[model samples]
Structures are given as structure tokens and as C-alpha cells.
Target: MTWLIVALVLVVAAAGLLRWRRPAWYWLTFGVTLAALRVLVRYGSVMDACGLTVPAPRWRLTLARMTNRPVPGPRAPRILRFRVTRTGLVLRLKLRPGQDAFDVAASCDRLRHSFAMYGVTSRELRSGVVELRMTGYDVLKRVQMPALAETRPMRVPVALREDGAVHYRDYRAVPHGLVIGATESGKSVYQRNLVAALAPQRVALVGIDCKQGVELFPLARRFSALADNPDTAAELLDALVSHMQDVYQLIRAEQRITADVPDAEIAADIWDLPENLRPVPIVVLVDEVAELALFATKDDEKRRDRIITALARLAQLGRAAGIYLEICGQRFGSELGKGITMLRAQLTGRTAHRVNDEASANMAFGDIAPDAVLAAISIPTDTPGVAITGDSAGGWARIRAPHTTLRQAVNVCNRHADLTPDLPALAPFRPALGTLAPVPAPAVESAPAAA
Candidate 1:
């Protein structure tokens, strides 16, 4: 008994130390098991207290009385499986006859508190099965991104999801995305992480930083084209539109519809074409879209219209032409301009960081997911990078990007500088990074040319 007590004391001490010094380690060693046990033990009582249990069947009571035995307790959802994950416990439950998934979802908060878990969320797997993901701790409090494997091209792991999964910025799946956040909202750092993730891939990057290239110029080595002002941005968008049209023309010409040609070999978009003929895809990052949207004079208005029209066109038609848009701004309301709302409608993916107001949150997730707006607005200012990410599919999750500095991103950009594809359409606006402090111009010039 004395030996067991001493071992328990040692375990407690280790748990305390690890909880303070290394949360992830503590979670793996002690937190997961203890949380799982607590959840299993308290499952029935917690469900009953939270009104998630159905009343005992009258037949059971009648049988118990006839047998002169105690009546069975109310029926709680049957736990089909209880599994331990790195972050928490996942419980798969089979609903009782009178219960449904909604009952469990609505009682998640009570269940979370009863189980002493940090977070609880539920999703119905089928008509009768619901999965409860109960996080043992606040996963987003301290961001630690796991090493990413070889993901699909144009797909980059940008942040950690609340459920301990990687939140990927998949350009192919989302196509065009809108990111909204106020000043000091960690939006810039998120963008930096995204840039770093994409630098190693064989994709063309284009930046339109109307803030005189303050945000994107530092990592210009990986960019095929960059525009720092409204005028240049307008010209750049026109060039992109032209390039997209050129790609479509190429696809049309490549549609060699011979009877012998396999349907899979027939070209439609750039991906469908022969690998040798397929052009490098483009990922356009717009820093501070409001800078390009706000206009005071008629000339500025005309330029803004042209930019918006071009962006709308790309968002609508660029998916087939191997072009994607990542537009970031503080606010993206209809007040920005007439075509602004239409352009926003084309962006299927929406990510909102810590915004200054609920209105800004609404602009991002309003029509898509109303609950996400609340989550976006409620983002504590103390937690900088935490944001809500959702798509047109109407699902949203909280995510926080690892803090990445400008210098780190610049290094990745310079290391993969050779991968920058030279598109003839964007050559005129290509940013000259010769003067950047980190990389030498001669080394950049010495790299082998792209085909």
C-alpha cells in the first residue's frame, strides 16, 4: 500500500510538471487516459442530468416489480465505441428510441463540463449514430503544427484545426477564398505560413499588395508577378484574364477528338491536357483587397471596376484555367463598391480571423454559416491567430495558424526561388528582388530557366 501511494504521488508530480512545461506530452501520457476513464464513468449520470436520457420503458418497470427487483435506470445513449485520441476521447453512441443526435448536440456544453473536457462537438454519422469529439484540453491555446506529408498540389496545411486535425488551405477544393481580419489579427502571419507552404511547390504565385508591396515584397523571389499600386494591379489582372483565355484556347486546340483517343486523354481544362503541355497553375494572393476596392475619384472608380470585374471573372472562370485567388482584407462589404459583393460571391472558401466587429464577421460567413459568424466575432483578442474557416458546403471549424515570421517565409521563398514559373503574360509585372537583403541577385540569375 505504501509503495502504491508513493507511485501515485510520483505520477501526480510528473503530471503537474508536464502540464506546465509540456502540454502535449502531458496530454499523451496522463490526460488522455484519465479523461477517457472519467468520461466512461460519468457518461450515464451526465446524460441523465443534462436531460439527454429517455425515460425507462414501462415494460421494464413491470418486469422488475414482478421479479421483486429494483427498476432499471433511464436509458442513456448506448456507447458503441469509446476511443482515445492524442487530443481527447471520441465516443460513438447509438441513440435510444426516444433520442436523436440533436439532443446530444444541444447538451454538448453540459456534457463537456460534466466530463471535465475542454471542448465537445457532435456530428451524426448516420441516422442513428452520433460521434462525440470531446477534447481533453484547449488544443488551440498553443499552436503546434505536425509535420505535413506530401499533400495534393496546391493544397497546403496552413493551420491547426480545433479538433487536432490540420486545417489545409486546398486551392483545388476551395478554388477562391476570402480572408477577413482587422489590424493585428494575425492575418498577416497566416498569409506568411501559406506562402511558406506553397513556396516548395511547382506553382506560379502572384501578389497584389497595394500597400506599396510592404507585405509581399519581402518574399518576392517565389512570385511570378506582383503589383504594388492600383494602376499596376489593374494591368496585372487584365494580363491574367488574357492568360486565362489563352489557356482555354490551348485546351480547345488540344481536344483532338479522334475516335481512337480515350475519353480520359481528351483535354478540357489544363489538368486534362497532356502533362508536358499543362501550364503551371497560378495562386494569386491579394494583400488588403480593400486597398484595391476603395475609390474616391472617377478614375479610381473606373480602375476599381476593372479590378473587381477581372477578379469576378477569375473567381468564376479561373478554376478551369489553373488560376486561384486568395483575397485578404479587413472588411469586404458591399459598401466597398458595386462589383465587390459579386466578386465575393464567387469565393467559395471563407476564413475570418479576429475582426473588430460582428459586421465584418457577417460579411465573411453571413450567407454561408451564421453560427460561424458568432464564432468569428467571439474570437478573443488575446488569441491572435485563432479564426473560423468554412466553405460553401456550410461546415465550419475553428483554426489557428502557427506564428510564422516574415524572415522564415522569406527563406522558404528564396530556397524555392527556382520553382517560380515564368509566364509570358505576367513577365512585365514580375517583382525584381535583386535588392532584397537575404538573397543575392547573381545566385537567382544562375538558376536553371523554366521551360
Candidate 2:
């Protein structure tokens, strides 16, 4: 007994030291707490008391008792499993017959208070199962994502979700996305992580950096095409639209509705076609979209209108053509001019880092999740990679990407430069990549000269 007591004391000391040194370590100690069982019971009791449980109808109870049948009391959700991670505890609960996951999700705040846990969020796992994520601490402060293995083609892990899962930028799922952040608000860092993750993939990259290519040029080895100025950007966009049209033509030709193919399997996106016949997917990265939207003179205005229209078209129709857009800017607002709102609406995925104002946050998440606006704007200025990300589903989460330097991203791109694909349409806009071997010296016409 004495030795057991000493061991317990030592374990407590070690946990306390770990908590003091590394806050993330504190989360690991939660699983071993003896109070966990007690807390579960207390949670169940509190849930019943708070009327969260679906009680047996009074008629049924009375009828059963009158017939001398077994009268069952109200049924409460049963604890299925609990697992601890570096950020939080995931508690799975088995719902009663009459109760569903929505009942639990609707009363999550009350559940959090009753359990005395940090933050409690719930999501339906399967039909009758619900998973509750209880975050012990803010995981966004120090982000460290697990090593990513590209499970699916073109799916790049961009950030660590609050629940300690990797969040992916899956072009197949969301073809176009909008990123908004203030200067020095970790937008560049996030893009760096994204580019680094994508450099190794078998996809073509195109960049338009109006900031004199300061942001995207260093990683140009992986980009098949790049545009650094307004005039060049306009031309590049036009070329992409032409390429998109050609791809659509190819898809249409290959798409023959026959008895062999099911209606569901009919070619709608690039993935639906055969691998050999499919064209290379292109990811257009637009750094500082505001640069392309704002103009001064009439010619500039015409140029701006052209760029915006091309971008809007790509967002609307590029998914089926295997063209995706990643537009990043310090600010996105209607003030940029007409078509800005239309373009923003087409981007289904929204990610906003620390912004200078609420208006910038709203520009990213206003139409989807108004609640996330405050969270995006409230991100600490010092937290570089922290962000609020949401999809069209109206769900949002606080995520953070690991710090990836520009040099690292550049190195990755250079190492994989040979993997860059050949696209004839983009050949004119293709950057002078370092992967191409020097052209053989022009053949000399020695015999003719001698004659």
C-alpha cells in the first residue's frame, strides 16, 4: 500500500511537471483520472435531471403497470467509449431509442456546464451514436500536425483541426476556396504549408502574384505557368479559360452515354473519365486577389474586369474540367468593385486568419457562418498560423498549420520539378523552370558551306 501510494504521488508530480512545461502534455493525463467514471455517472444523472433524456410516455408506463407488466423508467444515453488525444477527449455515447444525436448537439452547452469540462461539441457518428469532443485546452496556440501521408490524389493536408485531426484541401471535394487575412496574419505561412504539401503531388500548378511575384515566385519550380504582372495575369487567365474549354470538349467527346455505363457514372468531373484520357489537373493560386480587382484608369478597369470575369468563370465551371482556384488576399470586400461578390459566392470553402477588421472576416465567412466572423477577427495577432475555416455546410473549426518556411517550400518544389506536367495551352505562360535540360547546340551546316 505504501509503495502504491508513493507511485501515485510520483505519477502526479510527473504530470504536474509536464503540465507546467508543456501544456499540450496535460491533456494526456486525463485518461488515467479515476474521477472519469464518476464524471460519466454524474453526466448521465445531470442529463436526466435536465430533461435531456427521452422519458417513457406516461400512457405506456401506466398501461404496463396496470397489466402487471415490467414498467421501465426513462432511458438515458449510455457511455460507449472515451478516448484522449493531445488536444481533447472524445466521448462516444449510445443514444436511447427515442433520442437522436440532434438532441445531444442542441444541448451541448448545458452538457459542458454539467460535466464541468472545458468546451463540449457534439457530432453524429452513425445512426444512433453521437461523439462529443471535449477540449481541455486551446490547441490552436501551438500547432503540430501529425506527419501526413497523401492517401488520395490531390488531397493536401493544410492544417491541424481543433480535434487533432488533419484538415485537407481536397480539390475533388471543394474545387474553389477563398483565403483572407491581414498582412503578417499567417496567410503567407498557410500558403507556404499548402504549396509544400502540394509540391509532391502529380498535378500542375499555376500562380498569379501581382505583388511582383514576391510570394509565389520562389516556389515557381513546381508551377507550370506563372503571371507576375497585371497584363501578364490577364493573358494567363485568358489562356486558362481556353484550356478549360478544350478540357470540356475532351470530356464531352469521351462521354458517350451507353448501356455499359450507369447514369451515375456518366462523366461530370475529370475523375469520372479514364485516367489515361483525363487531362492534368491545374491549381491556380492567386496571391492578393484584391490586386486583380482594384484598378485606376479605364484600361486598368477593363483589365480588372477581364481578370475577375475569368476567375468567376473558373470558379463556376472549372470543377468538372479539373481546374481549381485558391485565391488569397489581405482583404476581400464589395468595395473592390463589381463581380467581387459573385466571385466570393462561388468559393464554397472559406478560411480566414487574423484579420485587421471584422469586415475582412465577414468577407470570408459572412454568407456561410456569421458566428465564425468574431472568431476569425479575434485570433491573436501573434498567432501566425491560427485560422477559422469553414465549408458550405455551415460548420466551422479553429485550425492551425505548422510553421513551414519559404525556403523549405522552395526546396520541395525544386526537388520535385521533374514531375511538372506538359500543358500546350499554358506553354506560353510557363515560367522558365530549372528542370529542363539545356537545349542541344543547333546543328551546323558544314557540308553546304564547304561546297
Candidate 3:
């Protein structure tokens, strides 16, 4: 009895050691061996465990009779190879000859669901092939990509998604985007990440900060122009409009609308143009857009109208002209002004962070996806940068931009100052430095000879 106990203890210790040191295959083998031993010890029957009822001698013969014939020589292995990429994991699987890829893909959906619990999934890449991509990993979830993306761009690492894979997207093709969030809801951090990512690229940065440029002024070295007031914002938008017109002219001049050249090849925008002729793209960032819509008097009303009109124009025509808008605000609704809804209509890309008001959440996604509105409103203040992002392609994704410091963004911008472009029209609206002449001190009257 003591020897039996010792033997059982040794078996458990051996199993533990194998489990700790060996790969998954060894653990599976150990489990199968243990199950076999249990069956033998408890039932004293190997045939019963194998689901065999025939006598031992005839059991092998019966199994052979039930099995089908083998295939031709050099049978291929059924396995797929994959690697985790920045956007997602990439799987490469070769299909068996005469096998349907679609059937395999449909079958993989169940596998994808099973893997989703661990942040992994399978997606069909092409016929006769597939990729095991990460659906939502947790580690790289909060990084923000640049607006003007490049082919095979270097990925900026952050935390992984819930699935344990990198998280990223190409924003250049996404064009314009709206970021709506309540105050202190981490929207600014996301913006900082976005700016830092784009600073190294050869692109124009424009900022409209109605909060006395509090949010964007620190990064002025990277911005071609920064507007602090509504009037200044108007001037900046006008200048951008002029720049858009120039870019449009350039595209038209280089337009290659021909039967031989496909629409994809036509030089319609900066991206579509030939590399040598393509000019850098421009990204316009607007902070607290509500200020541009607010008015206290009749004069303010007229100014708001012009400002909204210019924004609407930019939203309408600037996309194809290589100018994109990243408009952020606490609230953006049709009730804000006459052209507010009109402008919203043109902003195909939408992102809503945690918002204080349901109206703001509604403005961000109500027109497009009603479900997204619910998601936006449900976001808690504690998770600031978490947002629902919808693109023009009708696909929506939940993303959390990384927490980027204002000082880090400013430093990045300053380091990349040489790339900043000169926008002649916007130059006048730039914040004046202290070098400007000081106002004359008001003359103080004597105390009327001590009364």
C-alpha cells in the first residue's frame, strides 16, 4: 500500500514536470495517457474505451474495414503559417487541390469565434488562402496612426489589442474625421498622439483653437498656422480654401483622364498623382468647434455664419483636394447654426469620445449609425480616449487613442519644425508674438491736488 501511494505521487509529479517543461503536444499526450490508464484501472477494458465491441483479434480487422482508402503519394500537410502584423495578424494557408476556399473560409468562422476569446480570429485573404488575424488585442489598443499614411509605414508600438496583436489603421484613405468628447475626457491626448505621429511626415498642419490656443499653441512650431479666435479661424479657413483651390488646379493640370489609364491611375488628388508631382497633404485640426458656432450679438451672428459656411465648403470640397479636417468639439448639433447639419453631412468619418451631453453623441453618429450613438452615450468618463470610429466605407471600429502628453507632442512638433510649410493666406492670422508694439500706457490724472 505504501509503494502504491509512492507510485501515484511519482506519476503526478512526473505529469507536472512534463506540463511545465514541454510544449502543448506533450501535455496532450500526457492527458491521453492518463485517460488510458484510468480506463484500464477502472474498467479493466481497453476495447470498451476505444468504442470497440468486437473480440480483440477481430477488432483491428473491423476498424480496417470501416476506414476509407488513402490518397495518392506525397500527401500534403494541413497546416497554416501566420505572423502578427501591426494592423493585424497575417495567416498564410494553402488549399488542397480541388478544395474550395470559400467553404474553408465559412468553416473557419467557428474557429474564429473560438479564438476570439483569446483575441485571435481567422479571415479570408484570397481564394484558396486565409489569414488568422487578431480581432481585438489588448496591448496595442491606444496608439493613434497618422492621417497621411505611407505604404509599409513603420509601426509605432503600444499596448496590444484584447487578442494580443498590434492595433493600427491607415488614416490617409479615411480622409476627414470628427472627434467629439466632453471636457477632460482624454480627447486632447488622442489629438496629441495623432499630431506626434504626423509630425515626421511631409504634411501641412493647421490648428484652430478657440480656447485661446491653449490646447495647440504649444505645438505651434509644427503648425503652419494657428488660430486662437473665431475671426482668426475664419481667416485660416479662407486661406486653406485658397490652398485647396491651388491644389485642385495642380491636379487638373496633371489630370490623365484617358481610356488607357484607369480611374485609379488618374491624377485626381495629391495621392493619386505621380510621385514626382504629388504635393504633401494638409491636415486641419479644430479644437472646441462650438466656439465657432456660438454668437452673443448680431455682429457675432454674421461672423459665425461666414465661419460655418467656410467650414462647410472645406468639408465638401477639400477631401479630393488633399485637405482633410479633424474637427473636435464638446457638442456639434444642427441646432448650433444654419449650416451645422450641412457641414456634418460632408464629414463621412466620425469618432465620438466620452461626451457630457447626449446631443453631442447624437451629432457625432446619429445620421449614420444609430447604434453608434448608443455606444457613444454609454462611454464612461473614466475611459476618456475610448471612441467609436466610423469611416466612409461603412465600417466602424472601437478604438482607444494612447495617452500622449502635451509636452511630448510639443517637443515632437518643435523637432520637426523644418517640415512646416508656408501658407501665405494663413500668415496674417498667425498669433502675434510679444515683438508686436505694446499699447501706450494710459495717462493717470493727479488726485486733483489731494481733493
Candidate 4:
């Protein structure tokens, strides 16, 4: 008994220390309390009183009242499992008959209040199963993601979803995406995470930064091509379009519609082509797209149109050509002029960080989920990396990228500089690495009296 008491005291001391050092561990120490909440959900009148359950029949209520017994009610959703994660507790619930997942989702706010948990969110897992994520504390207050070692071709884990899952960008699945946020709103940080994640991968990096290359210039070593001004951005994008067309021609030549080639083996995309013949995948990162869109004169107008059209074409057909786009900007609206909306529609994946206006959030998620607009704008200014991310399917989640500094990302790119591929078509527009860091003047030696 004395040993057991000592052990309990040690456990409490350790938990308190962990809470002080890492709040994430503090929330995890409440596993027993989370499990007990399931009983409260099963027997308490909170679920029924809140209209979470179906209404009971009058006859059944009357009979129970006559006998001084509790009224019979519909079967409550069964808690099937508990997954304890660094963020919080995940409860898998099996819905009772005639119950819909939306019913639970709509009552999420009430569920948070009744359970006395910090936050609650729900998502339909399968036909009859729903996952209830009860966050004991706000995970976004401090973002820390587990290191990912697995490397899949053309995919990288970029952020952590609210449900304690890693959010990955699979070029083959989503193809193109748009990131919107104001300056210092974690947009740059998120981009750094992406570049760092992809630095060591066997893919080509191209950049279009029109802000005098302040953003992407530090990572010049890893970029196969880069453009730092409006005029240069226009030419680089046009060149990418030409390269995309050449790849399409290659695919056309490799395609064979014959019985000998299995239907699954037929070449429709770069992935379908034989491994030996496939070109390196390219990811074009556009920093501050507005710099590429806004025009000052007639000459600038023509350049803007060319750039926008090239971007639209890339978003439309670049997926099959082993090309993907990561377009980031402060704002994206029709006000940017022609082709902005069209380009947005083609970018199925949308991520909105703390923006200066609701309109910016709407531009990123209005067509997908209007609620996400509210969520995006609600992000506090203090939180740099919090964002609302979603796809065209109308599903959305809160995500945050682990803090990655500019120097860290630059180091990764420099470490993998040798991996940068050389494409003959892009050679002319390749980034000027020699100028990234100014070369020191050569030391002079006296000519030794003309000897």
C-alpha cells in the first residue's frame, strides 16, 4: 500500500511537470475523465434534453410516469473506441438506427458545453460511424508535428489537421492549390514548410517571386528556374506552358490504344508512362500572385494577360504533364482582373490563413464551404500558422504548420542543391545562383616590382 501511494504521487508529480513544460501532455493526462464522459453521454438527460435524440412516444412516457420510472428512449450512439492523441481524445461513435451524422454535427457546440471539454468537432467516417474529436485544449496555440520520414513520389506532409492527422499535398490527387493570407499571417511560414518538405525529394522546384525575390531568392540553389520581376515572371510562366505542351506531345507519342496494352497500363498521365521515360516532376511556387496580375500600363497589361493565361493553362492540364502549382498570395479576386476567378476555380485545394478581409476568405473557400470563410477570418492575429483548409468536396478542417524559419528552409534547399534538375528548356530562365550571395572581390597582390 505504501509503494502504491508512492507510485501515485510520482505519477502526479510527473504530470504536473509535463503540464508546465508541454501543455499537449497536460491534455493527454485526462484520459480517465474523457472515458467517463461517455457514461454521462449514455445516461444523462443532456443528449435527450438538447434534442439530440428522437422524441419519445406519449404512451411510453405516460407508462413510465405512472410507475415512477424513467421513460424509455431511443438507443444512444455507442462509443466504440477511444484514440488518445497528442492533441486530444478521439471518440468513435456508432450511430443508432434512424440517426444521421449531421444531427450530431449540428449539436457540436452544445456537445462542447455539456461535456465541459475545450472544443468538439465531428466528421462522418463511414456510412454508420462518426468520429468525435474532443480537444481538451487548443492544439493550435502551439504547433508541433511529428517528423515524417516516409517519402511518396510527388507528395509531402505540410501541416497538421485539427483531428491530429497530418495534412499532405498529393500532386496527383489535388493537382493545384491556392494559399491566401495577409503579410505576416503565416503564409510565408507555410510556404517554407512546403519547400523544406520537398527539398530532398526527387522533384524540380521553380519559383515566381515578384517582390524583388526577397521571398524565394535565399533558396535559389534548389530551384531549377526562378523569376523575380513581372516581366521575367511572364516569360518564365510562358516557358512553363511551352514545356507543358512538349510533355503533352510526349504522352501522345507514348499512348497506344491496343489490346496488347492493358487498360490500366495505358498512358494517360506521366505516371502511366514507363518509369525510365518519365521526366522529373515540377512544382511551381508562386509568391504574391498579385505581383504577377496587377498592371501599370498597356505593356504591363499585355504581360499580365500572358501570365494569367499561362497559370490557367497550367492549373487546367499540368497534372498530366508531371507539373503542379502552389499559388500563394494576399488576395485573389476578380478585382485582380480577368482570369483570376477562372484560375481559382481550377485550384481545387484551398487554404486560407488569417486574412485582412472576409472577401479574401470568400475568394479561397466561398465556392466550397461558406462556413470556412467565417472560420478563416476568426483566426487570431497572434497565431501565425493557423489556417482553414479544404477541397472541392466541401469538406474543411483547421490546420497549422509547424513553425519553420526562413534560415531552416534555406538550409534544406542548399543541402539538396545537387538534386536540382537541369531542363534544357528552362536553362535560359534558371535562377542566378552566382548572384545570390555577392562574391567577395579577389584579393590583390602587388606585381613584385614587375617581376
TM-score of each predicted structure versus truth? 0.88, 0.87, 0.67, 0.87
- Evaluate residue 335 in candidate 3 and report its C-alpha lDDT on the 0 to 100 scale: 71
* Candidate 2 lDDT by residue in tens digits, 318-408: 9999999999998888999999999999999899988988888888888899989889988987788889999888889888988888888
lDDT for 274 in candidate 2 is 90
Write candidate 1's Cα lDDT for 1-451 as tens digits: 9999999999899999998888789989988888878887887888889998887888999999999999888889888998887777888999988787888889988888899888898989999999998887778888887765447788889998887777888887789999999899999999999999999998999999999999999999999999999999999999999999999999999987899998878887888888898989999999999989888999999999999999999999999999999999999998897988889999999999999888999999999999898999999889999999998878899999999999999999999999998999999998876653675556445677799
> 313-405 in candidate 3: lDDT tens per residue?
888888778788889888888779799888888777787778877788778777777767777788776666777776555445566766878
lDDT of 4 at 221: 93
Q: Please list all clashing residue pairs in model 1, or write none if there are none.
A: none
Query: lDDT of candidate 1 vs native?
Result: 0.90
Q: Where's the lowest-lDDT run of ten residues in candidate 3? A: 44-53
Per-residue error for 6 in candidate 4, Å, reads 9.9
Q: What number of backbone clashes does candidate 3 have, counting pairs of residues 3 or more apart or in separate chains?
A: 16
After superposition, candidate 1 runs with Cα above 4 Å error: 1-7, 54-74, 96-98, 148-150, 256-266, 435-451
Candidate 4 residue-wise lDDT, 27-87, digit = tens: 6665436545653554346667556566556787899999999878755677799767666
How well does candidate 4 score on lDDT at residue 150? 47
